[model samples]
Target chain A: MPDPALPRRVRVHEVGPRDGLQNEAAVLPVEIKAEFIHRLAGAGLDTVEATSFVHPRWVPQLADAERLYPMVADLVDRGVRLPVLVPNARGLDRALGLGVREIAVFAAVTESFARANLNRTVAESLALFEPVVARARAEGLRVRGYLSMCFGDFEEGPVDPARVVGVCRRLEDMGCSELSLGDTIGTATPGHVARLLTDLHAAGIGPDRLAVHFHDTYGQALANTLTALRHGVTTVDASAGGLGGCPYARSATGNLATEDLLWMLDGLGIETGVDLRRLAATSDWMAEHLGRPGPSRALRALTHRDTPTPQDKEP
Target chain B: MPDPALPRRVRVHEVGPRDGLQNEAAVLPVEIKAEFIHRLAGAGLDTVEATSFVHPRWVPQLADAERLYPMVADLVDRGVRLPVLVPNARGLDRALGLGVREIAVFAAVTESFARANLNRTVAESLALFEPVVARARAEGLRVRGYLSMCFGDFEEGPVDPARVVGVCRRLEDMGCSELSLGDTIGTATPGHVARLLTDLHAAGIGPDRLAVHFHDTYGQALANTLTALRHGVTTVDASAGGLGGCPYARSATGNLATEDLLWMLDGLGIETGVDLRRLAATSDWMAEHLGRPGPSRALRALTHRDTPTPQDKEP
Candidate 1:
């Protein structure tokens, strides 16, 4: 039975192709990236973040976004929402030219990260995204605003929820339909997650328009996600096979593994249209391509067994 | 800030030496095992499960329990709780001979695991533990009952919560002071955890007498632990550096990592009296001794950094 405090159904926003790969050291061929997105959609993920339209110099791992977009266009026609990340107007134009119906804009909630990442202050970055968001909305595209470092920053320490709320309000006012709150450092606990959601609700930003993107850097992602679900936020962002690593923190672990999230969701009897076995196989296959084991416990447990005999039972 | 619904402090039952090593392929020397316990205690783990008195043939990894206990007996003098596992009257005798103050008896909630593990029916295993618990308590030793396969069984599938409550009641009535609920196969979710705790509470088994031993096989350990904490469970079982793996499941991951759990508890401002960096370093040290990397995200993130330059920030 589902917990009465949680939503009966959750939409898992698959970000493996884009967010997962962008942080990886290896750059895959465009065809492989397109196939990965298709496989994710085939496994019942309705929305898959395809790739980022950022400049090649910034993210060479996803440089083939234009080519990759066309390869998975059939899935887009079949009603899978393949949203790509757009940093600014130039990236927005690139996504629009590919007939993209949905796009996400990234923003830093900390001034340290904004200056380090975007070469601008937090206010300057938001101002830059304003016109890009407005133009995306004008073109009838759904815009998702990703607010990173919403929980903690390495340089500045714990971020204030009020500061995060201000940025969220600005993004919402700029016509962004959804906000994906990123715990980039993966340092947020359940109490902090509850407090943030409570503050957001008090500021008129309800759970209906919120998605939680938690990293497992400190192994708090799933627990934090559970707290968010209890607060009525249903959409969760997870990478396939726990693919992404934080470049800033130099941490091997990254986003919460989708398989791990599904294990909990499936056990709770909550509806998440994705098939666990098929998804684990996809991740295991991807791990082989990457020449390393996937970081997901569930994926490894499901796919790599040690030939258990009856006598091997724990005593 | 701590969540108002959760406990203010938690007792971390360090199970690295006993439950962890029992499943590991590499059996450390008695000296190393004793030193590991000392390191764990030095890192602020007040309760460290030393080793099991199970037969050498059945568990060769912990065969040197006799030699190990005396080496760490000074910790008991220092007011640290060092519990050992005793399988039966014979095991209890061995523990009592060493002047052990606390011992744990293992039981299974499902018939399949009871037969496979203890080579007896569930009732027969409980019947065997009856004398063990009675004798230990008669000798003024604190007896803990470890009920495994509480959430799932590979052969039988999802075990009923009512069945688990029945075993728990039996254990409590047989002079056991505490019961450690083990999700040996790691298939439980938050709702299942909440439901099982509620059922146990209704059955008059309160959280004070209950501890949770969750495995991270499916990566739901911490989330389920959070639910348990919200339900007022104060004691949590974890392995340092995620030292153990389930022999039955043939999975690499095992008990919830002490470092990972510490990260969450510390972030939530709940007191566990553990030094995160010290505990993580101990795990890393143990991993080197065992010739494998520890399966802890927080430990890896803290110790295995890629050397972050200022320009390596995530965008």
Candidate 2:
């Protein structure tokens, strides 16, 4: 009998071009960011979050979103998923006008992260996103609701799991096709993950409606991913080269690296449909461009050609 | 009720002083090496591999083993376990003469690694160690037998599990206190570990008589460790600051970092009695001396002072 906790296949949401670059210190040219997105899609990622439509004045790093949207429109037309973050109805309108077929709305479980990140409280942010989710879905665009700080906030030691479940359930009820639970601080362990998922399940949300987004801050990203996979979570969000960071936690690292996640997925015999070698090479290029090796160990090893191919295939 | 696959507590074998340092390119001063061992023992690691007795002609990095022994001799008398690597009868004599109560022997499951590393065929290497093992035990020393390339070899991929089981059983029958299965190339995955441990269990060997060693070459070490823990294996081998290298795969990173393993163990609430923060500090110091940051993400984040202490406990 198949294990109840493990899934047969997983969907990888590539967030390198958007979430990764947003948290990076050095901003890349529009052309380079465009190329990075294409490279990730070419690496066989089905879903690639292209960019956020938050006001350019607020996020100058993604100022080229208007120009960037046209560059990857071909992939969008080809049915390759390109999700853009929409903070409110205004952002949703901007995305829909660009012929975008998928939009993601962001909210935080804690008032502190919400106020600091979005300049609104949790209730205020969710209320703002309600119309955005409705408008995006009404326009025939699939909407994904992001629940950041689901595990814990930086200032808050541990956010109550009941509050997390309430926030997630509200998102689902508000027409979010999926809710990506964010471990913003990377402090959540396997036990925390298991417990949170169990509580969520008890709160009438199943793994089928959930995706896990974890940061590698404390080095538990992959282990947490493994636990999530065992609990039937088939969708994972990762950044190429582990790009991005938490504003509150200065020393905290980036999102789980795509290559690191792929290593474990490939090892578990679970299909991700993403080409490991190509994704690793792309991260390597981005790391070199950044002037430092990013946090992904697989990228470091693969780029160095340290991995041993089978003798039958070796020269 | 507790889960059947997981263990309550685990024993972490700190090989940073011996295995970790030997693979490093920069040879540290003998005093630094001695102090590193003491620091590891001070961090609550009861078993710290102090050094190796291999010919100085072969491992000039550890050429100061003779001088190193006397430095930490106080820990040995204080009931802190210090196991040193003894590669041969001559090496065993050197360790025994130092009044070492514990020693380790090396063997390879595959002939290529055995031949390339020890200059002997697998059978010949095992034959050569029979007397050494006998002599070590005769002197009342606890001997650990390491079977490397158990998962696969550099030149030959996928060593037979039966062969590994046979080698381990022979070592056990020869009176070795424990057998550590080494994934020398670090190509091992959770499934590989599960299958190997399953076969080993069928051979009548449980976790008590076995320890698992892994290299983080592909970034699957911690995930693999979780799998091993589920199978009731309680002993894990780790290196501080993620020091060391594979003789076969140079670009392949070192053994699993102790901090990385500690993150999972602490998360799982599995007791190891080792202080995570203290160990991370020592690795930080060692990494600074090495002129590079070590691979442990926990060390990177902790040393960055990013972790939040609980408010009720914060000073």
Candidate 3:
């Protein structure tokens, strides 16, 4: 029998190639980015976020999306799924022209964050994305809606759960296939996450159509994920080597590390089909090119697993 | 009213001074170690692991335990708990000579780890600790037993849970006031942690007499801590700035950071009585002295909470 304590299989949506590198300080070459995506797929990640179609002025790092998509577009036949981020109707059109099958849109639960991040009010931003989501859905693209600051906004200590529920309903009503509830500040504890998910479930957004995107800002991401999982949420968004940047908590690490997520899943006998060693090696390769350490604890341990006998410090 | 989901108050056993520094590659001066301990206690960590009584040759980093103890001994009046590690009869004698009221003994759960870490068989190591635990209790000292590799051993993937239970019973029987079950390799997940705690409860070692010492090697420490808390565990071990080295996972980060733990406890409405900002400041100070970054994500966030708008990297 499957373990009742955990989901039988978790769908780990790998956001490294796009989400990870987008927040990084150094702008890696487009070749490295494509190779990173290929390595992630080779590591058995079923879904890898390829790139975002935001204007280059907004995110110059991911500006090569036009050239980057074709390099790995053939992977669809190999049973790998690539989801690209489309910020607006123009972006969605670009993705559609590239024949993208899945796309994601983002929104903040708080007006302050919404204004700061999107230069529009929450209502205005939602109105702006309504057509984008409709057009993307009409184009047969599976859309994932990222509800950032759902747990707590960076400007406000917490956005009301009812408000988050409202946003989730709006996004779902706009034809999004899934909603990734993000604790944008990573200040959420298990109790907070559990309460939010419980409220969302009561609001008719059950685990089946929901995912959790948590930052490690306060180091609560994994714990929050476990809480969400206990509430039957199976989809989790993680970045390889824990890439990504949090404009809210800039000094903080970004998304929960995929390797860290897989470690818990592996120990619980939950299947994700992601080869951890290969993922760690890919992350290690990326870290070398990034010229700094990745925030992933598991990646570091696994990468250094074969080091010589350790005796200089106490275990 | 306290949240039913978490304990009302958690006794954070700060292990940074001893466990954290001992694993670090760069050894700070004894005065810095002493100051760090003072700062931890100043930050309101009631239980601080001051130092170890092991021989200098074995743990040269803590060689000044004798001198260090006297510097912070005054904290006893301030309602702080300082427990010093004693490896054997000689170590206990050294601790006793200094009028130490709290002392700890360590024994590995696996023969392989026992040999590699202590250069003794599991049975032999326990045999050697028999006199030490006895004499410490006889001297009116509260003894803590560290059951290393209780969850999983580095050499042997995992030891039998029954074997861990037997060791726990023996340590309790030998007058160890508390048994700190350790995931020495930091590989334990929530499921594994829950299962072991269940078995330990079945074996008559309830949460009342148990604590958990987990490394963040795989980024599972806090999640494991949350699971332990949900299972009624109230005492959690953490090092400030997530210091310490895993002689096992040398590249792995140290114990769960106190700031990270407090962040959860604070959010869950659990009382820790520790100031998060001061703890973060102390960790930041220590990090600067160490000439490397601290691994505590919360400390990093709090340390950089006031930095100018972050557009340099992704979160």
Candidate 4:
């Protein structure tokens, strides 16, 4: 049975094609990236972040975003929500030209992360995103504001929830329909998650307008996500096969695997509309293309047994 | 800050030497196992489970239990609790001969697991453990009962919490002072954990006398553990560096890494008495001895950045 404290259903925001592939060292072909997004949607993911429209110099791995967008246009026409990331007005224009209906703007919650990741201070990055978000909203596009480093920063010890609330309020005021709170360093704990959600609620930013994007760097992603769900946040951001890693955190792991999240949701009797087997197969196929096993324990457990020979000798 | 609903402090039951190494393919020398235990104790693990006294043929990796226990007996002298696993009366006799202060007996919550793991029916295994637990307690040794497959079984489907409560009552009635609920297959989720604990509590088994042993096969270990902690379970079972895997399950991963558990507990502001860096360094050292990277994400994130070169290309 589902926990009474949790939502009855959750929307999994699939970010494998965009957030996931962006950090990958191997630049997958545009066709492969398009196919991956298609497979994820086929596996019952309603919303798939297709790719980022960031400059090629900044993210060479996703340089083919312009080409990739048109390839998966059929899925978007079929009612699959393909939300692409737009860094600024230039990226927004690129996304708009492709007839994109949804887009996300990335912002850093801390000055250190803002300077390191965006090459701008917190205020400067938000200032840059304001016009992009306004323009996207004006075009009848759903804008999602991604607030990175909401939980903690590597350079700064512990993040203040008040600081996160302030940024969230600014993003909400800027007309972003949803806010995906990012634990970029993945150093968040359950209590920390609870405190942040509580603070956000106090700031009039309820769970209905918020989503959680967690990294598994310290193995706290799923636990933190659970805490968020208990607080009535229904949307969770996960990468297929645990694909993405944080570039700033020196030894960061990938985002929480969709398979792992599905296992927990399925066990809880919560509805996710995801087929675990099909999703694991997609991740397994992707793992082969990457020439390395995905870091997701669920993906490994579900698919590894089918392989004739075990990869690791430990188990 | 610690969650008000969770426990203030947790007792970590270190199971690397016994449960972890027993599943490893490599058989380390007795001295290395003893030194591993010493280092774990030195890293602030007060209750380290020593080697198992099961038959050498069944668990050859931990076959050096006899030689190993005496080498780390100094830890016992230093007020550290070093409990070893004893399968039956014969195993109990071996532990008793070595002046072991505490020993744990293994049982299964499901009939399928009982037959598969112990090669005996549920009743037969309990019948066998009766005398062992009685004898150990009669000798003034603290006896712990390990009930495996408390969540789901590989052959059987979802296990009834009432059925688990029955086995737990039997174990407690058999003179066992504590019961460690083992999700051997790692298929459990947070709600299931809360339900099992609630059912056990209804059967008069409180969290103080219960410990949780979760595997990371499905990556739900830490999340399920957080639920257990919220339910007031104070003792958690974890292995250093995630050293073990299930021999029965086709692709089961290792136990919840002690380093990962430490990361969560430390982040929650719950006192565990463990130094995270020291514990991770110890796991990293053991990974070298095992010739594989440890499965602990916290261990990897904390120590991997220190190495000059990156190991995996994904991140």
True contacts recovered per prediction? 0.46, 0.42, 0.47, 0.46
Give the C-alpha miss distance for residue A25 in model 3, angstroms: 4.4
Superior by lDDT: candidate 1 or candidate 4: 1
Interface RMSD of each: 7.2, 5.8, 8.0, 9.2
Query: What CAPRI class is candidate 2?
Result: acceptable
Interface RMSD of 2: 5.8
Q: Report the poorest 10 consecutive residues by lDDT, candidate 1 chain A.
A: A306-315
Tens digit of lDDT per residue, candidate 1, span B80-133? 999999998889889999999999999999998888888899999999888888
Docking class of 1: acceptable
Which whole-number lDDT from 0 to 100 does residue A32 have in model 2?
87
C-alpha RMSD over true interface residues, model 3: 8.0
Residues B74-110, candidate 3: write the lDDT tens digits: 9987878899999987888788888789998988898
In model 2, the clashing pairs are: A5-A230, B5-B230
For each candidate, the DockQ is 0.42, 0.44, 0.42, 0.40
- Per-residue alpha-carbon lDDT of candidate 2 for residues B33-124, written as tens digits (9 for 90 to 100): 88888889889999998889999877788889889999999998888999999999899888888899999999989988888888899899
Q: After superposition, how far is residue B214 of candidate 4 from its true place, in Å?
A: 0.4
Q: What is the C-alpha lDDT of each candidate?
A: 0.87, 0.83, 0.84, 0.87
Task: Evaluate model 2: give its lDDT.
Answer: 0.83
Predict model 3's lDDT versus the native.
0.84
Tens digits of per-residue lDDT for model 3, A201-234 = 8988899999999988878889889988899999
Cα-lDDT of candidate 4: 0.87
